[model samples]
Target: MTLFETFAAHVDHALDALVAAGTLPAGLDRSNVTVEPPRDAAHGDLSTNAAMVLAKAAGTNPRALAEALSAELAKIDNVTAVEIAGPGFLNLRLHATAWLDELRAIGQSGDDYGRSASGAGKVVNIEYVSANPTGPMHMGHCRGAVVGDALASLLEFSGYKVIREYYINDAGGQVDTLARSAHLRYREALGESIEIPEGLYPGDYLIPVGQRLAEHYGDRYVAAPESEWLVLFRKAAVADMMEMIKADLALLGIHHDLFSSEAELHEAGKAEAAEAELRARGLIYDGELEKPKGKEIEDWEPVTLPLFRSTQFGDDQDRPIKKSNGSWTYFGADLAYHYQKSQNVDAMVDIWGADHAGTVKRIKAAVNALTGGKVQFDIKLVQMVRLLRGGEPIKMSKRSGSFVTLADMIEEVGKDVVRFTMLTRKSDAQMDFDFAKVVEASKDNPVFYVQYAHARIQSTLRKAEGEGLGLDATQLSLLGDAEIALIREAANFPRIVESAGKASEPHRIAFYLSDLAAAFHAYWNLGNDQPDKRFILAHNPALTGARLFLAANIGQVIRNGLRLMGVEAANSM
Candidate 1:
């Protein structure tokens, strides 16, 4: 139904003719022989590397095959010209009218124009922003959160059943520290001069927790032992911080379907359940760990510890499951948590930061050991993001981290810029997020440029009202050269989105929008040189209707592209 599909089918028929003439094999696989927009527009409207890739497989010279194929393609009416370029690439220029029909298709479809069904009914879980509840989310976590959320939206649009989840690290020594910190606040609320010493949290955010404790208990636990209030204070602070974190996520338009708690797992003895499973396979045992190569402690000696045989499944060395103090190491809980995911989800993807790269092998080894290579666990690492303002880097303290929270950034630059810029690069590559650069209303900034296209079309429609255009489907099919070019660019949306969803890379959506924006801007600028090319045809009512249809098509593409990136396509700037 798409213009590309029609072009491709013609190419297939030409290839079939070549086969019938005995110039090519009768049953050659033509799936990889694609008719697509060329990287170099000067080459042609479309190009195919069919000969280059199939030459060796087919035992034929590439240029000779392309020459033979081009001769057959010259018969199609809409194909204006065919040229065999360097290394046997087939370049095609389509008749101007073909593009006009594409405009009609897009305009008639509107918002539904580029909706893809590539994912069908597949289920996928995207787990991201599993930051600890100990503090507020900094700029470091914001990029991945936005990227994951946008990617989920993109996949859903392409027809995937997606579940967005967050893992809550609410169990362990960190909560104890939080409790102690709250106790200090509690005493301070009672008018006690309690110094927030080196070991406890000193942030003013938790002062209210102390106030609430004072208001509820009224000095009941002031003289009581540490045990009574530690549990109560820890629970309250953790719950409040989690709520704050959730609110912060909401500011950026993100929500998780499930919030799996670490404390719940511990309280339910899931770690013990995992340990029992490992013990049955003889993977859990008491062992002595190797001392560090350069940093040995004063009492450095091998100590009996509960260890997991991670080396058997590809880790560098066996890893500790329990520490010398008889407490589980942080990695122990991760093993149980991941092992549980391996059982629950059909397939799993873990989004983590670059610092977690060092731990990937051991984690993978544990999954292999736990599930015996049955379930595949893919770990995607999101690299560091350096937030900049007018090209100046912002330094943030690790303790305070950043005051530029997710909410702060969204309130500043908006959700569309936040999502699109985050996906401008591969997840593993380090990215520079500049506040001054993204807000620029130029082609260099994809968000504004794309939005401008939509606004321009709406403005053109307003101008066309005086030109006697109907703004209906009957008027849309009468498109000219610039109009057709815009429609062909828009038609690429569905295909580009399907490619992005299958690749699990939302950056493709950003890239495609950039290209589409370039096409739209160029077409719109052409009106300055030619009066007829202008969207409003003052002397011709039928032609004006056709141009109005083209303008509507441009708006449709912009809306579809923005929807995929979780951005808005505004009718006006």
Candidate 2:
């Protein structure tokens, strides 16, 4: 157990003791009780809200309950003192041995130090970067991809069975445009001069698909009517584009466990099945939707369609599952897609772009109605990222086919830089990715600061090994207040992993690592003015060994954190 968890159990025992003495009522609700570090270090080592949470149920004020709880908590072996502050908060100080034991635990656990079982094997399916198959992966999809991928790793570390999924939007009209574009390129490859029309994809990335088609089919479909070859060309072009998309994602070290196709979902009648079930339950019906909100339409008309009762679940209006022409709408297909995902998982998470924020409520409502609220569902909307260079905006236009591709970004700044920089901000906040600032190699750059700390630790361990000063016979008691403070910071990794996983925010890991790195750097700088504080002392091998052991474990924590972000910790900078 972590230091926080260990003390939580102690608090539980203390509460039970209060019940045994009839000082507090039995079976009071304690779920709101929390044990965490005090906000200020001057307060104490650990803080708990047990007294304030249960005082009302026990027929006592918060202060009296805190006073009674403090006496029992004082009996813990490592608890040095318990202080009551504010209304009823209990802050407990621990002996240095508590942190020393945790430092040793870090050494013992290594890469597995921060892992937890908080998720308890619950299966969670995360769908992210489900971009349309009409173009290459761009900066538009980068943030959500990295966020979802890191979240998957974090949840897995917290013991959740996670499924990484990508939804291919191949059943839309955009794919037909891609098909026509590919046909144009196919004719170009067959020695015919062609111009890309305004509505078709114009990027040179599709040039190879046309050449391959020309080689395989050799003029068979070059002059055929649109009906004779639209499906065939759409299939081929989507297959090629998907290959390109996967390759681009690989550059950022992202790979999905499943690639679900929208076309396949329709072909298998999943949408029809979902509609039938919801209609049978009175959650869907044939109705006419109101006119578009906040807009004046010269030729607006109401038409009857099968609509899902999304308004009952907090949507602004009832959503249409199918249009009057009998084809499924995007919401209709997406609703079925989520239903298919819910069949095999206990929960589902969707990482979507902020542009799709308007549809979140309806989709959530559909999922709730389909599952009868039995399944846990969450949708995270990631805001846009503006690429910049030296504080100036770098403009891009996807329609003009001049936008920056994921491959180009990865090739320029490297995958580690791209992945780490993408997560430095909250997913919902707009961020500027300045190419110059991200690779600045200064403390202002979190990626560099964290990696530099790891590299420094590895270099120190190497020097210690060269000097034949091993960590085998070290005494942790030699670690004084300064070293113990560093240990205190390092020991929060497990708590961080659990909290970040529970909150579904992987950026918290990046923020925590930055804090830990700053602590280690401050501790490292202490050796410059004080000769005895340095890690390497030729006169005293014992002290050097203890410090080296501490440094080694801090490096281990850094490695574990960087692994979740999919960034490599540099051994030397």
Candidate 3:
């Protein structure tokens, strides 16, 4: 158990003892109590709210309850001091031996030090970067891709059985347009001049698709009518586009375990089955939806269409499932997809762009009704990333064939920089990703700062090895207050990992890394002015070995934290 866990168990034991001694009522709920690091390190090592939370239920004032709890907690080994602070908060000061033991645990566990079973093997499905399979992924898709992938890694580290999924939106009109564009390219490949008219894909990306078509079938599809070749071209176009998409994702080190196709959903009648199920449950009906928001209502026809009673579950209005022409709407396929996903996982999360903000409520309502509230679902909306270079907005990319593609960004700044920079901000907040600042090797750049700390420690270990020094734990108790402060920061890794995974926020890991790195850098700077503070003291072998042990564990934690963020821990600057 971690130090926090050990202390929390002690608190619970003290509470149970209080009940046995008739000092408190039996069966008092203690779930509200929390043991955590004190905000101000000067206050204590750890603080608990047991007294504050249980005072009323115990029929005693908070101060009196705290005094009583402190008396019992003071007897626990390693708990050197327990003081009652504001409003009966119990601040604890553990001995340096306690932190030494934690350092020893870190050395023993190495990479597995911060891994947790908090998720308890619950099945989780995360769908991200579900970009349309018509073209390469743009910068608009980068933030969600990085965030989703990092969150998946975080959950897996916390013991979740994660299924990374990608939903291919191939059953829409976009793929048909893609086919027409490919056919135009095919005609061009057959030596006929073609103007990619307005409303068609004008990017040269389709040139290869057309060339391949010409190579395979020669002039058969070149002169064929749209009806004779639309399906074949659409199939080939989607397949080829998906290959390109996969390559782009691979550039960022993202690989999904499942690629669910919307066309397959329609082909397998899953959408129809989902609609029939909802209709049987009286959640589906034939109705007319309000006119499109922000559009003129004069041209809107008041015709009846198939609708789902999404408003019953907190949406603003009922949503259309099928058009008046009997074609399934996009939401219809989405319902089936989510239903199929819910059948496989205990929880599901969809990472979407902020442009889909208006659809969140209805989709949530649909999932609620379909699963009868049995499945846990969440939607993380990632705001747009404003790419910048040298303080100016970057506007275009030749590779994207439109805006900047993810591959373009990856190629320019590298995968580590792109991933780390995107995760430096929260998902809901818009960020200006300055190219000059992210790659700058300065303290202002968090990625570089954290990586430098890891690299510096590695360099220290290498130097110690050259000097023929061995790490010694017997002299760990010789560590001073400054060393303990660094250990305290390192000890918070497991707690931070657990909290980050629980909240489904990978940005927390990035932020924590910056803070931990700052602490390590501050400690390193102290050695410059004071010879006694250095990790390698030639005159004091035992002290040097103890400090090296501490540094090694801190580097291990840096490596572990970096792994969680999908960033590499550099061994050299």
Candidate 2: regions farther than 4 A off = 293-298
Candidate number achieving the greatest TM-score relative to the actual structure: 2
Candidate 3 ranges beyond 4 A from true positions: 57-60, 291-296, 397-400
Per-residue lDDT tens digits for candidate 3, residues 1-573, read: 888888889999998888888888999889889999988988999999999999998889999999989998999999999999998999999999999999999999999988988889999999999998878888878899999999999999999999999999998999999999899999999899998777788888899999999999899977678999999999999999999999999999999999999999889888888898899899999888777888577767888988999888778888888887888888888899998889878889999999988889889888888888888999998998988889999886533366777788888889988888888988999899998999999999998999999999999999999998878988998899999999999999998998888888999989989999999999999989998899998899999999999999999999998888888889998
Ranking by TM-score: 2, 3, 1
Model 2, C-alpha of 134: deviation from truth (Å) = 1.8
TM-score-wise, the better of 1 and 2 is 2
Residue lDDT tens for model 1, 1-573: 677778888878887787788878777777678878888867778888877876777789999999998888889888899999998999999887677667777766777776667677566678899987876676789777877887788778877778888998888887888888888888889999987777667777778888988998889888889988888888888888888889888877788998999888888787888888888889889899988778758888789987888788677778998889976788888888887767755556678998998788887777677888776667778998998999999777534433567777888998778877888888899899899999997777877887887888887787677554657556555665566666767778877877777677778887887788788778778878877777676687777777677677777787787787777877788
Model 1 alpha-carbon drift over 4 Å, by segment:
5-35, 54-84, 273-287, 304-315, 368-376, 398-402, 466-478
Work out the TM-score per prediction. 0.87, 0.98, 0.96
Q: Give the total clashing residue pairs for model 2.
A: 0
Q: What is the lDDT of candidate 3?
A: 0.90
All-Cα superposition RMSD per candidate:
3.5, 1.2, 1.8
Which is better, 2 or 3, measured by TM-score?
2
- Candidate 2's residue-wise lDDT over 70-126, tens digit each? 999999999999999999999999999999989988888889998988889999999
> What are the clash counts of all predictions, listed in order?
0, 0, 0
